[model samples]
Target: MSEQLITPWAESRPLPPYKGVLAVDAKDFTGLPAVLHAPVSQMIPELVDQAMARAGLTSVLQDKRFPANTGDGIVFGFDPAHLPFVIWPFLKELDEVLAQYNLSVGPRIRLRASVHVGPLPDEGRPDDGNGTPRNDTHRLLDSRPVKAVLASSSEQTTHLAAILSDRVYEDVVLGGYAGLHPDRCIEVPATVEGKPFAQRAWLFIPSPSGNLFRAGVLAAEAPGGPAEPADAPAQRSGRSYRGNTQNVREGTAVMGDVSGNVSHTSGDTRYTATNQHWGSGDNVSGTKNTAAPGEQR
Candidate 1:
């Protein structure tokens, strides 16, 4: 007999809306695929499992309620209420584990992850049918700001660069639950094709010393002297973002595109994209996907 579909919280049963969505990607995945892909491909799932366990949330994996799948990376959902306990711990452990794995192996393993809170498909519903907040979370991962953090930190002691949407930062992180301070968050814009001002998120780098949310800790520990200011605009090839300079770089890094690569420079690694401008605006066009969240009974 065919196996029955096991729906967590029940099929068509009222369920609480997903409080947040998290997306992760291996850095420079295509750059050194020959050397890194095989090992990275093998370790991602193990890291995910360990991270979930570290957060004391192995049930989310067993029950299949979280719907986390790893391809080149991973994406998962969790209750916003668990932000302090669940997601933070997961990232903390994941960072350490990835560091350990990289040390044990030859090549370094780094990740770019994003977190956003919004409505998502209800339990038992199909995610592929709509773009949902989950996709938005992925878009944030592709944003230049996030890539900038990851790229610039390539030569540093940091291994993970995480971006939190403004909503998540303002609501949860700033609310004082995760022990993450507001000053550590660097604001940046995210623009998607056809979507103006499509991206706006905050970036945070996890430190090797285990102080995940402390600003400047990673830079201090980095081999290179003090890096860019925590709040400096993402610096691209020939330009930067500041006041009304208009001398900004524009680019688009489509989500899930294997061809995309992060460009590295002597000062800071530049983000690869179709355009080079990183300006402020909500004037761009194009609609993204979102799901009508469900309420738990």
Candidate 2:
């Protein structure tokens, strides 16, 4: 080798192998008393084992599984082949496992999870599953959409909310390998805090819990929030939000805390109309709204 060309590929750098990345985070984990941290953290593996068994993928984490602890959660990598199973029975089973566990625990554990599939580098450390996919997994877990789903739901019923990368949604759910119904997934954006990462992702809730309302999945959700899917109404039966019972168009009564404005009227009303008599006890006025005689008009 008297002379050698300094070409880019001359020094072969092998590509990292593709892996299925999963991140599960416990909501308000730090809010729990310090004495419970170790016990709660120890239960994670048990929860995953139960979930894996229920999904019939007992070997999903058998070997080379790198689990990184984030104090309140874990980020792990496994064979991509098991991803479909993870999405299917695994997620639902995890929800059930948490629910069953919650029945006995004083401070229940609720989770936000994300799933992604891509090339992942061998970790520098045992728990450090390195690569962009790992980063993506955690970002999706921290995304606003997924957080909103959990925030909007009653803490008692909804045990988990998850975000799936578009790749996983297309490859596993859409490809029908996982038996997971595509309709159960909601489209949302994944954005990382103070980072330039943003992408389309799919959201899944094992149980909608008490998050449902007339026209929104989250309370005070912006107009740009997720569009209500066509079949959503049928799923709202027997669900309650906050302390209020949802009765659809029949009527709804909310007695819990409201962070936003609530308005209603019995007569034909225009939010921007002036000098119009609209029947209402509590209503929002965007413009000039006439009131009862002797009252502020």
Candidate 3:
């Protein structure tokens, strides 16, 4: 017999309209050293699916595609009400999943989530055949608290740190274009077992080929000290990319894409030093030429 499809309680049953949007970004996936890239990419969607299931929320993985340089990735929508109970715990699951692949979550692979609450249009495309909302409408499925959780960008900050770490290899990179917001990075402090840990951030790399890849923490500072002028690909970095956003400032490392779109921004910086250490050709440990299952290389 075929397995029964599980529907979210919110979908199957009548529910009040929710009031927030939760945007999630996988942590340091792009900067993962080859050893960790495949596994993290594979697990991210699964963990997200599991969180949605546990939250009794309905969601659909959208059709948006990342740029060519990025690795296998997934982006789905979820209800905001499930933030604390479902989303956050689901992110924590990364620790165990990474271990199975001989990887650790580290301060790097943590995720970043942004939540926004406002008037959302009711009419939009359907995300699933089940008659669920699509596009930005799905964002309304979350609650205020859930929205707050997402806006906190906690997990995103952690992921950003790992992205900034040169030791980590990324399967995807985003935002490094000439006319976009370069500060696509988010910064946040993290703790483990009651101990203070590292801060995290992210970077958006916009390839000239029109593909967008996101690097976590390691992305901000290139592996070597400030890139040499001759070696510098004509990429732009700084707050000016953000346009008129007053929140951004100089020395912000915030940059823009070729078309001048705003990326993301935050204030974490631990991955800079750590990644430089690992990616500096000193620790070339791990299986080489081993691509993750279902990946091209």
Give the TM-score of each candidate.
Answer: 0.61, 0.68, 0.28
Candidate 3 residues 105-172, lDDT tens each? 34234443332222333334342211222222222212221222233334322221112211111211
Lowest-scoring 10 consecutive residues by lDDT in candidate 2? 273-282
- The model with the greatest TM-score is 2
Question: Evaluated with lDDT, which candidate comes out highest?
Answer: 2
The reply for model 1, stretches above 4 Å from the true place, is: 1-16, 34-39, 63-70, 192-197, 208-297
What lDDT score belongs to each candidate, Candidate 1 first? 0.58, 0.69, 0.30
Sort by lDDT, best first.
Answer: 2, 1, 3
Relative to the true structure, candidate 1 reaches a TM of 0.61
The sequence of per-residue lDDT tens digits that candidate 1 reaches over residues 193-260 is: 34433555666766633332132213232344334434454643223323321122343322111222
List, residue by residue over 143-257, the lDDT tens digit for candidate 2: 7668866876787888999899999999999999987877677665455546667677888888876445432443322366535334333444332233223332211223222
